[model samples]
Target: MMTFDPLGDGISRVEHLDHMGDDLRVVNAARISFDRESHLECDDTGQWLQDQDEKLIGFLAENEHVSPFFHPQICLRITMPSFLAHQWWRSTVGVSRSEVYRRYVVAEPQCYQPPHWRLRAQQPKAGSGTGELGAERQAALSVEVERLYRDIRTLYGQMIQEGVAPELAQAVLPQATYTRWIETGSLHYFVRACGLHTGPMAQRELRLYAEAVSEIVGGLFPVSWKALTRHTAA
Candidate 1:
């Protein structure tokens, strides 16, 4: 399987779908400034082919000349809870997405059960911390959660069995339902997204998702990924 289990319980996944271009492509795109094409003009030097190309990519990143990063594109298949998907969609600016539609396909009803219940953030606006409510309260919350999930699932199944349209039946699904989508964008966009989703302020679930994506992006473009991170730090 191409999928990586970023979040256990099979609730969240990040799969490398397809990609185009590469580190050299980003370098060549910027090399156009000199009215030169690396592919046509550069000689093939087996081991030293990209010696200076690395420096050029680093230079582009350092100076915030990010357009070259757009030369490389990547597509990912992601399966995440709807809550995380909502955050992901909000963070996306330069990416294209195609999500599975319930109108055509029945959504697999799955709800995320948190490892532990968390008390609301004290900050009043964001974040979550450990629950102050003792083990008994935590257990109580878990029990209620399971009951709610069962009820929702029962209703959804009943509707389907009654010949209700899948689209209408989907309305009863919970926010924890896993949704799948193909997200395609330039390497630059993915990097930018990583910067945000991996930050301290982002949602925890989405941050985990972003970290998984970064692993794939980094493996594909090591030098470029380094340059992007260095620039992002600055």
Candidate 2:
């Protein structure tokens, strides 16, 4: 499983639940053109098979043959804040997911507490910035955020005690509320997701998630992962 503590809370993780296909699988899928198949365990050719597979992957990437790349599928169990999940779910093409349903289950609320508040960017469209705040101001903001979380949770629990439905009670929760989901998709889709979410100006939280998952993917399929990033970066 792949895991990351993007918020430094260690509460969030992206678990590599299960996956299918690999570098050789992509090569075999493409080799259908020549009515040939690559035997991954066939080391009788020494490094010849490995070298050929890497070259073939590069060729596939260069020529825009994405179908072969789609052969490798990855399934991830992602636990993240609701806001990041919303942005991730927006990259829907070639991706599929199912999320935890709060309508049926009632659980204690968990939240994302940022290490510190980021100041609003001078350019409003730039989002937040690392502008420093006084110790007093920072401490006050931290305390206020924690107080607000407690207040919201208390109200939510009171509603539940009063016989309110979970789905209705959960409406009071903020974007920082933690959520979980299982996402399964092709390698190409993940490459695309990484390309978007891990870019220079991507949301910081989502970028961390993307980078962690890409690390796992790269370790598992080095050659294909390299080919994918090279092609996408082009």
lDDT leader: 2
In model 1, the number of clashes is: 0
Query: Which 10 consecutive positions of candidate 1 have the poorest summed lDDT?
Result: 40-49
C-alpha lDDT of residue 85 in model 1: 86
> Could you give candidate 1's per-residue lDDT for residues 29-121 as a string of tens digits?
988898766542355654333577888888999999999998889999998889778878875656899999987786558888876766778
Q: Residue 165 in model 1: shift from native, Å?
A: 2.3
Q: What is the TM-score of candidate 1?
A: 0.89
Error of 2 at 225 (Å): 0.7
- lDDT for each of the candidates? 0.82, 0.84
Off by over 4 Å in 2: 41-49
| TM-score to true structure, per model | 0.89, 0.92
Error of 2 at 194 (Å): 1.0
